[model samples]
Target: MQNQSFLAMEDPLDALCHHFSLTKALLPPNARIPPTFDMTLSAPPSRQPTHLFAILPPEDNARVPTLMIPVSAGLYGQSFAADLLPAGTALPVPHIQNGNGAQPPCVTLPVVPVSAPHSLSIPLVLLFGLGLETDRNLLAQRMLPAQVIGEFPHFPAMVGVMAKLPEQQFEWYLGYTHGMWKNVLALAPKDAGLVEFVQMAHKVIVEAGRLRGRR
Candidate 1:
């Protein structure tokens, strides 16, 4: 794996051009475009790029900043003001496990409704990273709660795994949603054991759900 992260840190435009085929010539003249790393999730090969606009809150409506998001097919992006989540919702927090003084590996937060008469059709992308063995383990544990919550009505969500290749200096992302896995950018490592990890996650989640139901 070649580290591509350095490319962005050194010359972002060059990185974008090399990776996504985006170029300065594609933009308007005298555009003050800043360097940015495209972290948008992967989409199907047949999909086309789409523009997305943010839905701002009343307080920030006075000075809405120009935002550009590259969206793929079957995806929509929206934003809302921060507010309290519904009562009885479990808030994800870091918990020390096994009394080993080790911090929590992962935290799963609830995707609460932001608008009145909320629609569940909106797909939710859950972002996660794989860097350390602890992270993988934590991801397995956290996935159980994520799957459990996904069963609830009015929440359509999927897991997006972000794998950083320090050697390559770039990132790779894959998504699992609607009963399928999709690669966003580059392919994951053959030895990453992602399939085994996902299988074990599902098994543990099922067993945990069974135990909870027995209670």
Candidate 2:
């Protein structure tokens, strides 16, 4: 489709809705943009500079920032405990007894508490990772409470870039605002809509960063 055709369309949302052959009922209420958060796995400080915008309040100034841990093994164990393990055997060694009478490897996680409507409780992505077993297990039962709407089990490496923000938001920018304009400039269509999208992404990054700063 040409840019002119898109511009000619009366409503961008309507145009998109029509393109997707979607019904009005299928659309989100008020066409709202969803909240975002970073879920990259816990990594060293060097990986954090890129996602400064993604940090939330309370977490913003964390001298020792929270690490994103990919709980791939943990998630798998939780999701399919019975099928993978022998009868009466539990894959989560500490939690269950293996039918073979052997203890499977287990990792302890840390738990942290958050107050309601608190800064860090704001919805965003969260990733899990495996680290050396420590007396301080940071793994909480739920990464966040029910109120938050972020994705879980995200990959850790993406922390250097977008981390846990919506994948759509991830693609719209480059490393940071410095690369924001250049990234958009390389778009294939080079249309006004594309420009608008990139600008929105840039705004989100700035806004999210500012929000973190406030906390």
Candidate 3:
């Protein structure tokens, strides 16, 4: 319950794991840190700064980012024959690459709030935010194997930031974005464990997908 007890922890993350009273959350990837959101899917995704870390929930794994969760993801960027998509299908969810990451992307998820036994015992806390930014970048199914991203419907949408707070509703542009860290120290060291980080990232993805508009 005190920093004194956490001082003996060999790994800060382990201490984090201990603080959370978790078992499977150990050895998380990226030390439970999200990508710096610097450049887009392109460029190097350097590690950013943070004050919190969490384990990925069982709902997701490495290859599967979103577990078929549905959300009101605004309007469709493109139009496709209803038969091709047939609802509840895997989507190559487009990642919009525009401005440098400077603010948290605004988004929402449907999470059943739970009471944390160690909520008060844990010595640290972290808040997470996500953006619902997607590229109207279209890919037509009719094109088949030839045209990788044959144009579909194009909806011009900008990336916005939404953050998670204790007992609060998600609002857009309510958080900070990447390259925005000013005073916060890096939660994980340079050689932080990747296993736990990946696991933690899985949690973020799952949270973001909580309201996924489509598959």
Per-residue alpha-carbon lDDT of candidate 2 for residues 64-169, written as tens digits (9 for 90 to 100): 2332121233332343222222333222222211223353322222212222122221211111111111111121111211112122233222222333445455
Per-residue accuracy of model 1 over 50-110 as CA lDDT, tens digit each: 2221212223233423222222212222221122233432323212122224532221112
Write one digit per residue (lDDT tens) for candidate 3, span 12-129. 3333323222221222332333322121122222222111222232333333221111112121112111121224322333233444468432211221111222222111212110
**TM-score for each prediction?**
0.22, 0.20, 0.17
Candidate order (TM-score): 1, 2, 3
After superposing candidate 3 on the true structure, give the runs of residues whose Cα lies further than 4 Å from its correct spot.
1-4, 24-215
Which residue pairs show backbone clashes in model 1? 2-168, 3-168, 3-169, 4-168, 4-169, 5-169, 42-184
Write the number of the candidate with greater lDDT, choosing between 2 and 3: 2
Q: What CA root-mean-square deviation does each model show from the true structure?
A: 20.9, 21.8, 23.9
TM-score of 1: 0.22
